[model samples]
Target: MGEDIGLWGVPLAIIGGAIRVSTPFLFVSLGECLTERSGRINLGLEGTLVFGAMSAYAIAYETGSPWLGVLAAMIAGTIFGLLHGWICSLPKVNDIAIGIALMLFGMGLAFFFGKSFIQPVAPDLPAISFGFWSDYPQVQAALKVNILFLIGIAASLGLWWMLRNTKIGLRIRVVGDSTDAARAMGLRPNVVKLLSTAAGGAFAGVGGAYLSLYYPGSWNEGISSGQGLMAVALVIFARWNPIYCFWAALLFGGAGALGPALQSVGVTQGYYLFYAAPYVLTLVVMIFTSSAAKTMTGAPAELSITK
Candidate 1:
């Protein structure tokens, strides 16, 4: 009985760690969900996220308001998205290649701008307390949840509802399913994809903002460790569903924290391997969820990757 109880503690700790660390991934994955649902992919979201983080940190340091930093990050993200969208809309420009280019550009821009602002002090976002009811200190610590996590959950629900129950959602799906069909229905496919990609970029940007302004509260080249790229993979695994993206992001987040968690428990032998857990899980999930045959059977027929 004692051994079983001790083993159960690990799962609970992982869940808590997941919630703590998964917020950035959740925002980015949800953003990718919207972009991919419109039959486009924005690999530049990696750049958007890093730049947003730097922008948020800089803005918050200057303004002394974390919320203001968040708003600035969104605006910056929108601009980045717009750039990607505009470039991709041009004929003879492959969106995938363009996305890669934008990503490199964005990363370079972030590192350049972030150099001068590395040590600036900024206001941090406040956490909402729900642990007052807990008697044990460990329980209270475990239950300390951030308001951003709640916001992420609410955003996921809202996105899911919009995609499933709105006319705009229908248009987006139609455009993704078949551009010819959308044209027949009098909808502009390019316009829809552009808007979706822009919106997704904004969301990803905000996710990046959260990292710099709230989680770490400083800027550096190592601020974002491929959360943006993993988020792209997460969208595929979630099948372009915002709600599923939330869960998948959380799972990845937990995987990310496993190394630190093990270190906390004094087990540091395979720390690097633990750090790779999220990527490994992502590859395995992608293989299982996105086989060529399965895609042919169920994916949106017009999706370029599937085709």
Candidate 2:
């Protein structure tokens, strides 16, 4: 197996893995970006993602439609978001603490309710096969792209455009930048944040949908592996730009693919090292972006860390 692939197979494996893995990261980061840009943070997203995964899988199993599962996940995520937003909007509640609590809550809900879903044969999301150009089975398989991947890319571009040119985008920016300014303009910061958080949670849910209905295509306790939490750091690394989030997601996805990619080419000696690529890259990004001298140059003034 190793000799058949040789050194050339590693890169191709990584590319294929990136396409598969980047979808979740892209959606999660975009969700976090939207919430953060509205001057709020929801660390509960990890739980949200897990719950979303469970919901999507269960619904798909029941309905025989992957798209319906996606919808269910988004709805589940919105409920989680509303809970987080409502609590955090109170006079003295800490968003981080609430987020942690919600994370645990979300996880608990998924675990308890999802027990029946384990091992069920759920409907899987369809992929777009670009593999027809290749005669080799490996090449053809590697080129199979999921429909959600393309949607994620388009969504990122749309987010960037909306944030730069729309009225609602302007409000989100202003509220995120300065609460007092928003209040002066007679806008309710809490209301805006509530909506943004819900929207963010929905996006995270969609990411979770990709996990179960598309990629690994299953429901289990250990499905996430911190992809949701990692996206928070990703938001910072991308400097909160939606377009940059897309590229950053692909990069992270590529890093995550390192170990599997090498293994595809029969190089398994350092498998764990390659698997650690994403975490290492995350730490490096945090270190570089952590300069106090910069005063968080691109950060919103009302952001939790900033305030």
Candidate 3:
């Protein structure tokens, strides 16, 4: 059956890989969207992600429950986010600089703590199999979806609705777009930014948990491979919209899957080059979205990147 599929399998495999690979992008981008929406940028999510992955793996290994591990990761992410938010709120401190420092700090902490868990096997998150009728094992494997992806989808929708409908969301948008305006309205811009940054970290941490507990399903120093950082460019491309973030993440996932899908069909030539697809796509997105003379549409007025 696999042989019969022939070259047709490439696209199928890509589709499967897209579903698998897009989860982390989906999460980190969405989280950044939240942070940027509040007039702050968090470059340290990479560290938060790695740390989350390590902690999730460790907790899950010790507790025998992946969900507990996920919770722990979220808490850890919140702490990291809070730290970033607090430090950035200090006078003369740069958000980007603090983020970079935190990223390194988070990664260092993760590595120091995660060394022992490199050899330990932890419980993995379960997937929902949607390809029950598939005759091919590859198809079945491709159809198996993780629960976190679904949660991310819901989060996107919920975030979109909140941003448009809720009072708190209005405050966040207000603070992000203009701190002075937020102050005029009696909103505490710093507090809003702090909470939003922390919330963003929580989301990034979940993305990391998904990495370690599900797809690629392991804890290691090399697990992230810059997905956390690339997500910043993705947020720019997504125009800070949660819905757009979802689609963009899937697009990135498809691009990332291309090389692997080709290799599955014995197309090993230039396979290493194909791995660069996501990074290339990120550059393309950044180039097309950015304008030196004009601020990006839908961008917060207070956002440093757009300035």
User: lDDT scores for all predictions?
Assistant: 0.82, 0.89, 0.92
lDDT per residue for candidate 1 within 1-307, as digits (tens), equals 1122354445555766788778889988888788878888788899999999988888888888988888888888899988998888899988789889998999999999889889768888777757679664445555667777889999999999998999999998898889999999999999999999899888988898889876755778988888898897788877788888898888898998787666555565876688889889888877876766665333465666776
User: Compared with the true structure, what per-residue lDDT tens digits does model 3 show for residues 1-307?
Assistant: 1354788778878888998899999989988999999999999999999999999999999999999999999999999999999999999999998999999999999999999999998999988999889788777877889999999999999999999999989999999999999999999999999999999999999999999999899999999989999999988888899999999999999999988888888876788799999999988878777756545989988988867
TM-score per candidate, in order? Answer: 0.93, 0.97, 0.97
- Per-residue CA lDDT of model 2 for 1-307, tens digit only, reads 2245566667777778899988999999999999999999889999999999999999898989999999999999998888899999999899889989998998899999999998678989999989898766666667889999999999999999988899999999999999999999999999999999999999999999999998888889988888998998899989889999999999999999888877777675878787889989889887877876555767777888777
Candidate 3: give the clashing pairs.
none
Alpha-carbon runs more than 4 Å astray in model 2:
1-5
lDDT of prediction 1: 0.82
Model 2, residue 188: displacement in angstroms?
1.0
**Judged by lDDT relative to the true structure, which candidate is superior, 1 or 2?**
2
- Return the top candidate by lDDT: 3
Residue-pair clash count for candidate 1: 0
* Residue 215's lDDT in candidate 2: 86
Higher-ranked by TM-score: 2 or 3:
3
